[model samples]
Target: MSYSEILSFVQFIHYFTIIIFLTFNITNVLSIYEVGVDYHAFGTNFTETAFLTQYHISNVRSIVLVQLQGIADRGANFVTLDIWFGSEPGKITDEHWLATFPMSAQETTNLNQYAADVASIQSKIDDHRLHLNIALFWLGIADYKIGNLTEGFGSDYLNASEFTARIEKTTDCIITAISNIRCSDGTLLVQTVYLEAEVMIGAKPNQDWFISTHYPRFLNQITVAGFTPAIYFLVDAREEYILDKDYIDPQYPALNGHRCMYWVYRSLNFLKIHQLPFPKRIDFSCYIDRNTSTYANLTYHILNDADAALSVLDAPKSYGIAETYYFIDDTQRKEFGQAFALEALSNPRLSHIRFWTTPDAGGKGIHIAYPFAIEDFLPPLKKISIN
Candidate 1:
């Protein structure tokens, strides 16, 4: 594309407060979730809800389970199911814009590109049949936001019980689905699946409730259920990355800055409770573009604090689920201010460097199919290498 075209495209994306184009060396690409048909196994039924509706989960999940079982029986050292959710759900973007320009390309579409991504991944997995590392299962329900964060920005008071319940429900669904996908040798098909969600900003005490109480309980619950899944949170700090200082209102306290330190400190420090071998893990994820100033600094603090927390307690090990969600093309990668930080990132806790939330996935705002936001090429970068 010519410079003028590229510039036009960049400005157009700015029109939507979104941009794309990420090229990276992927260690393990994340698979998209497709809601299959009614699923009934282990004497429980998986049904549709407001967030996720099943189209064909049974056959897909079963095929994936059986494939993983074959791999396990073959004595693979470990297994990782790449699907981030048990049931995939599409999100709505840009209400006010769509309210005006209905004919434009911004018409809201479901996760069409994400579905295609998994379909291809499934084909590749099935074609090999012997080596199965990735299979898709979805988990998402975002109704846990506080006031002004809820739908339509109404005065929805942040109820602590309701807040925890939403996240708890989503976590339970993920665990229930994976725990039931047992191999023929009585082993669970999946050892770990990485799932993502965000805890909307609200009262500090309410956020603390999720961090201290709910996190430990979640840890034990997954361990007891023999489910090891990484629950990751992707925070949205589009305008300014604010670090919460004494119950600030304008910033998110849930897993950001000092709150993230507290989360790491109180999460039982990734150590086994009740002598369980596998501790349930959750990942802290954030977006980093060249635009934000304090993001890289905050990230550095997060990693350092996590290390300090683990070291102070002398925890046996550290969590390897830390990731950065970003999409920058080669041109931007070389010139962007975050390029130095991307190369400088040497956090041992960091694992996956994902190029995430393209227009295909509806991104931060509503979008339809576009040229710049292709997922086939916009896979994640490896943690060790940004080039």
Candidate 2:
């Protein structure tokens, strides 16, 4: 071939190769990528257990343990129980069916005993190479009922001061437990906790106290203490709370739940903007009936919004993504899981998703599924206005 013709042919081949490479790259990006699944509370119940088994069956890494209750005698593995304040006063009583197994008054008195109990549980978890997490309710600074009236006398308990004290105590116990446990490589166990919204806003506090005094105080306390905590909004997303003009007050920042999320997103975004450490996970616990169209639609919107936010910041989406394969009972498993999965498939950025209900058998339901992959993506800090 002539020299000019040879050069032209080589150039054509180069261009063709580039085009093919680009096409392949684009195709790969569009293909079905199996992200990780996060089963909230892996050991909570048979459903959680089944979900974890399925996660293993599907080869999912990164799971978040939800309210893994009952920490009585399981050793350091049962450390999760040390933080348990009975859900209600009746549950607190030994005579009631719902009553938590009585701990001797001495067991409750010795602060170190609580520490020891937690440490034992942590040790067990570490031995098995399991992850541990805790979820705390944020009852607004008020006294609330513990349980049903039929079971026990309704009593005013856990006001602001008491709740704060409990939180501090719980934090100390968890920290001690975590410190005692050694991972496979001899590293201390990493822990996470959830701060529930109802616990914060249940008292209907004025917007100022709710946001400034309560919310910021809670965040500062947890952050300064060196625990990785995430804001948990357990609201009925299907309800008209978002649309209600009076649902949230603008002056008091923390009282605004929707705004709280926006603020959190911005705060985390600011950390990314400035290259600081911030919580990498977001957990939104919705009480959707699953069978209702309203539940399906509400969850879909929230998931899509979360996906968009994560994509924009290139952060991995966490929580509300997993399928709840296990339930305390199978009453809503099929319906809920199927609905959750359908909504999950529409999002592409999900890294880990789980479907596990809590309380095992008798406790009130704790069902949540995370639908995102848990990949290590270091997001850059960005400063954004919360207003």
Candidate 3:
């Protein structure tokens, strides 16, 4: 071949090689896993609740049992108990006294007794080599008892050094006991320390400061001291929006009539953007409703948003994941299947959506569906070799 023809042929080969390299590297790829769901509802029937608990234990085995379980399940490897006690019918008084400072000796004794009871349960969990996670929801309990902190307690009361100090003390006691427990791996049984934002700020001034101050301090104390503390966005704001009209309008801009989905989305998005450590588990107290729809929408939106952000950052695949809880029957599952299929097909960033059904009381069941994984679909950089 002539020199010019040979040069043209070489150029064709180089371009072809570059195209093949880009195709292999830039194409969409995902590693999908069959993620298990652990369901927790505060007030389901015993049989129904037991079925749900067993469902989790049978599947994930390393499941984290939360609030409703009276005793930690033998099969679970991680157990979580809420610090707020009022959720249990008999323990309402314990929650009541924990709210005030100048407690009578009886109240203090009752609180400590309840704390000891929790410790006893933790001991059982440790015996089985199960890890433990605690969800702190004092703000929800506080709101349930004291009304809005802004109007009733005022910002000063919420931010009082005395109140915060007491909270720190109670939490410290619980943490100390939990930290002593050990898992099969001989590691501390407690895997995470979680708190609600409302508990930290409670209608105090400068809402972001609630996160900036309390979250960092809590995480630092646990992490620096060699414990893993993950942050969780409390569903309290959504609950408050549903219950109190006055609480809904002024603070959360995302609530619009019956559509507050954006608000939930923004909350999660804010945490993700700030690169806060994503908790492996989450709890949603609200039942299915328009507001719940908003929560689901917000979840998908945040996942998509994360994918976009990761692509821009040129990060690897599978950057983040989120799971949600639901209670639905067979008919409801069919309806959700159709709706989710539509959402999944339309959204390129999403990988898979799965639905789960657990036996409930009276042989009935509840269904939950959520996108279990999210992979970063980034384009590969051009590869050019120099001799």
Candidate 4:
């Protein structure tokens, strides 16, 4: 065909693809509803009234559960079941509590309870108005108590099969319960799985290496079971966010800065596999020494404060691995005016780097701020690596 014909064909294909994509997305938009919050350890404390009120203003339309109780009676439409694997009925002790893969008899009993919980929750969903989308078993509990994190999964720790079985059992329970519901063919239940296997943050090694190394192994299993992945990255930060004894775990971060900092490193590395949106842009100026006169001096400031620098440098993205750029006003740049400090922000190794000030600030010395940190979490950095 002629060159014009090829161009015309290409344009036609593009528009056709666009039309199909738009239609698919529109259908999804109309169907899917998300509600609920990250019910991490707040499992028992959650009340439908309190929970709904919290997100009512935000218009959240989906639910993500870390624990289950009398939610079914609460009139919830969509529920995301965070099927946890840990402990058994009766007096629970640390030695035998951690449920391993393949599941021991006691562990099986625990899973039975999970199934019962789902039935109860689903009964509520069935009784409530509207449809429901249930994400089965979001891996295990978002804490270190579930497994031997230091050694990682398998042998002495979690077995992929155990997690799979838990999910299977949970799904089976839902299916059976829904079938038994003489109360309706009214509630529409769409079954999907949202899997997550997160590492803890405060132990000696914190199982960081073990969890990271074994992450893909478990994640692949989840996918093979046909589950979608969800983020529990913030769970590591929560020990710091909620200060009460109930939420406070001695093995996790207790300060907001520490929590935010944990996410920075953990997320940066996790981004290598799964891309997520970057969180709101936290200002570098907040952590850096404000009085530093020049860009070179600012560089010294960063070099002097390595921990702070890493926390700022490795800030987590809001969504999966999208490119991000940070803007610095000329005034801030003047701090590093013609020096290595200025180069630090301009490092090509970083994702997004912009050097202009926004009009809203009216060009005042751009004071930097982070989302959670009221104060510095870590001691000043002693050594640094820009890479």
All candidates: TM-score = 0.41, 0.44, 0.44, 0.33
Backbone clash pairs for candidate 3 read 261-294, 328-367
Q: Tens digit of lDDT per residue, candidate 1, span 3-22?
A: 99999999898765532322
Candidate 4 global CA lDDT score: 0.32
lDDT of 4 by residue, 91-175 (tens): 3443321333223344434333333334445433234432222222222332333455344443235454443344455444444
Query: Which residue runs of candidate 4 sit more than 4 Å off their true CA positions?
Result: 1-33, 37-75, 78-102, 109-204, 235-265, 271-387
Model 1 lowest lDDT segment of ten: 33-42
Better of 1 and 2 by TM-score: 2
Give one digit per residue, the lDDT tens place, for model 2 in 145-201: 342223321234434455445445544554443445444555444445544332323
Candidate 2: count the clashes.
Answer: 52
For model 1, the stretches where C-alpha displacement exceeds 4 angstroms are: 1-54, 57-173, 182-205, 210-217, 229-282, 291-305, 308-310, 313-323, 328-330, 333-348, 358-387
Q: What is the C-alpha lDDT of each candidate?
A: 0.34, 0.37, 0.37, 0.32
lDDT (tens digit, per residue) of candidate 3 on 1-387: 999999999999999999897555334221222111232322343323322123223332222223312233222223344333222222433222123322223333433333333334432323432344555544432322343334332222443444445445545655555555554456665555665522223333334444554565676677765676654332322433343333333444434332323333344545556665544433222222334444435444444433433333333223212223333344443343333333333443443322222223212454321221111111111001100
What's the distance in Å from true for residue 361, model 2? 8.7
The 10 consecutive residues of candidate 3 with the worst lDDT sum are 378-387
